[model samples]
Target: MSESRSGYILLGLSALLAFSYLMAGWGLPVEYPGTVALKASGILLLAVYAARRNAYLLAMALALSAIGDAMLALGPSRMTLGIASFGLAHILYAWIFLRVLRLRGMRGGMGYAMAGLLAVFGVAILIWLQPGMGELRVPATIYNGIIMVMAIIACLSKARWLAVIGALLFVASDSLIALDLFKDYDPAWRGPAVWISYVAAQFCLTLGLIRERP
Candidate 1:
């Protein structure tokens, strides 16, 4: 096989490891060390792919996400740290997406449309989870706003389809976690739901960014 194909194979393996370990936590009851290691592996591999392409911002975002994954998997005590890490990652992603938009120059109407959608989407989420977000209301709202802006930027940029999908999936992943944290959900659904969306989100963004110019 060609080198590119082999590299993809390696990245796929890391993502698979992450998924497997996350599942093990839900089913196999894996220990923290093993789970966190595997969880971070997938994102770290994506960072490597970004590095290979010299996509510096994308690499930094992925690397920060990997750190968040590790922090989160370590357990409840470290949740705040994990959130902070992922928050930074989202900011970096927003930077990358906005830069892409500036360079590509979206059509006039499209920018307004994206902004409206971002506002509507972010407000709707805050409304839906408002009661549950009590103490977390402010931070959650801010983070939601950030990611929504990232999604909006992606929607208006050249890589609209891929970036949009990836951004939304990332939102879904975090939303599930938020649900589990503040509201009631089927206990069994928690782990699978979070990891599935999270992993897929990273995969989409990483692959999409790799395919496009830096």
Candidate 2:
């Protein structure tokens, strides 16, 4: 199929997933089948689109994200496994973003500027959540580092702004997760923000790859 047609189909799937989440009341314990399915399906569709276009880096990233969602949806007890899954996903995404930066030619000051911004925010957040991080501190720190790398490389992408936006959304979603898991923050708001930002991030990343064509 044409990229345009396939992109629309993916968009429809994203809308369906979001619509289903609303119908499901958007509550906590996002382990339900419907929620998990929605969470995975949209990104999975994007993976398929990437595969069709032979964009393996983007495809692998989305596939890992879908797996991470399923692992998380298994329940609270599986949070560790979910974290590991997402950690790997972030690593893969970082690789793709870095590759893109090299291929696109670095933006000199702008590139370093974005990386600095991401690093500062990442370090600050990790410090803020350190006390409660406790046993999971190591894993959380590594994950945050990987994601920060992805976010920084994304900023180096001038034309594929969709990917940049998606990377930032991914960072935001993880931040909400950190707050929800560590700090005694607002669950009511955090819950929805997590899912929405996640789904939107995947959508943007996938569509951005489709538009970029490689």
Candidate 3:
């Protein structure tokens, strides 16, 4: 089979595994295994196909994200590991954004401003519900901040508009997850929106990097 065909196959299998895990519901060991398999396969494909510096960086970010997913599958008893893994993933994402910014000769002023504003707004809302969501305030705040920063950086980068839009959608996905976890807002729309946006974000970023390759 052609490399492109293999890439697509890997990508498809990864998506299938992730979807299977998502549908497996809470309190199931199968979910974690499926998620881990999906993520590992996804990252392996991405790394093999990534042909540029930016693409490689994005692949690294995704790999870190996979680590976070695996940690989450370890269940709430290992919540600290999950959170730390995601936190490190965000740091990797930050590095990716910074590299893009440097390549495009873009400053981070706008991104910083946007992130600050969103952080304030999100924190305010979280604080208002602190009596109920007190345990989640800190983690939610950190996650939101990372997302906002990522979106802003994506917007300012020289990458394709699709990539920027994908980044925004990713932010929306994570925001929904946080809301569901913290505020009991488990809207049925959250699952599809989150996964679709996430996959799109990865695809767009990958394509953008490929296009920019020398």
Candidate 4:
């Protein structure tokens, strides 16, 4: 009925969908096309919530993320599309963090150190995955570089701790995906692990963007 009520309802539904999808992924034997929609549904709801809050950039980022989820779920044929979608989303996220940096005026040396560490980590990851990336190498490298910069700026911006945590979680999730896909590190736990980190990352980033002033 009221705005606050609707917000709560949407968040509750999103949480429910996320939990249900996680359980289904862990227990279910078969995945249909519908599963793509199911995987993206919770994040889509969060995107709607962001739009209602007038966080247009975050909303667009979330929507792109949802599209990426669907593309990835569609199988290897759509992998490029999935990477591109998520790559764009990361660019938007970096823009948001850059805005925060503008507002804050670059105060801390610690942030620079952290960002440097992240850059090093990104380079190492790229080196490891480069051998197996093949035709996708260039695009995947660009995407990896973008996300690493996003996470680094998120830290440097110092906008909100939740956003920082979300950025880190995102890095963890994507790193796992790359490792599994390119480095042949597939394990039974990879799917659920990636999903949990990704869902948590999106939820935190959404709330962080909504609540953050800078």
Q: How high is each candidate's TM-score? A: 0.87, 0.87, 0.72, 0.95
User: Cα lDDT of model 3 overall?
Assistant: 0.62
- Candidates ranked by lDDT: 4, 1, 2, 3
| Candidates' C-alpha lDDT | 0.80, 0.77, 0.62, 0.90
Best by lDDT: 4
Query: What tens-digit string does per-residue lDDT give for candidate 1 at 103-190?
Result: 7777457667866877786788678888887766777777787788787777777665666688879988887888777676648777
Tens digits of per-residue lDDT, candidate 3, 54-172, equal 46566666676666666665667766676666676666666666666777755366655655665566566556556555666667567656766666666666556676666666666
For candidate 4, lDDT tens digit of each residue in 4-88? 9999999999998888788887675436876887889999999999999989999999999999999998999999999999999
Highest TM-score model number: 4
Where's the lowest-lDDT run of ten residues in candidate 2? 22-31
Q: Which scores greater on lDDT, model 2 or model 4?
A: 4
Cα lDDT of model 2 by residue, 74-99, tens digit: 68777777788788877877777767
Clashes of 1: 0
Which is the winner by TM-score between candidate 1 and candidate 3?
A: 1
Ranking by TM-score: 4, 1, 2, 3
Q: Indicate the worst ten consecutive residues by lDDT in candidate 4.
A: 25-34
Off by over 4 Å in 1: 107-115
**Model 1 worst lDDT window (10 residues):** 106-115
